[model samples]
Target: MPYFKPFKMIILGFDGVLGSVLSGALDLFSFTGVSWQRFSNESVEPRFNVQIASLGGGDIRCSNRLIMQAHCDIRDVTECDLLLVPTIGDSIDKVLKQNSELLPHLVRLANTKADIASNCSGAFFLAKAGLLDHKIATTHWAMPISLRQIFHWWTYKKISL
Candidate 1:
């Protein structure tokens, strides 16, 4: 068998992360490989390899109260092509407080060669990690304007630069 490197994409898992977003993205990426070819009656290889990672490297509960056993933890992942942040379940402040420990891991991952992307409230984590500094970004539609102000206030120097 020929060994070809596939694009590695890691999805960040957290306590309040929406299960749908995580599973939805996982399923979408899963379909990209040879499975799509079989599903479509054509021959094609998957371009991406996906994995779900959490802080403790264990099962995580979503905002909808679903338990998801992550494939691994942030500590287990040395590097990847991309890191995807999913939607958060609660108020921005609450979620950020609950996930404060994730900042360092996210920061380390962001500093790597891997690209970082997020959906909805997930952008907060990326921003808190300093990945969004000086980058144009947006968050979940439901987020209030005040949240943006708070973020701007917190990272005033970085964003201004």
Candidate 2:
């Protein structure tokens, strides 16, 4: 294996985002080394440095009324190897408008060429930030029509089994 530093992942936690999604990403990434040892009988150092953040930090109230505590604000994040944008609830348009505060920070991070991933409604954030321009992106099934209507630069391909 190549010598490497831990990958820094800054997960953006926002108001009205699904609390489960944030926790799911955290739990999955936080214990990668432990999981490997447990399942593979080999010990290795953890590879990811994960931080859950918001626009201004503090409490992030979700659409389901679940409040998650963020470690810091996006402004405090100086370097990011990966940035995961969690989804807001049903109204991607409303959430995008209300959370415009995160745009500048996101744009700066994108300019750094960090890998950015968005979940469901979070794709709208990427689109609005122009991060998804000329990039392929997929959103929740219920919202793909709207996503396509608003952000035509990205090609969304639907697959059926």
TM-scores for the candidates = 0.85, 0.87
For 1-161, candidate 2 gives per-residue lDDT tens digits of 62568889999988878888888889888887768766887656677889998977878888888888999889898879999998777477777877899999899998885888998878889889988878777888888788878876656677897
Candidate 1 lDDT tens digits, 54-154:
88888888989999998888887889998999988767678888889988988887778989889987888877777777777777555636446867643
lDDT of 2 at 105: 87
Global lDDT of each model? 0.81, 0.84
Query: Which regions of candidate 1 deviate over 4 angstroms?
Result: 1-4, 40-44, 153-161
Cα RMSD, model 1: 4.3
| Count of clashes, each model | 1, 0
The stretch of ten residues in a row with the least summed lDDT in candidate 1 is: 152-161
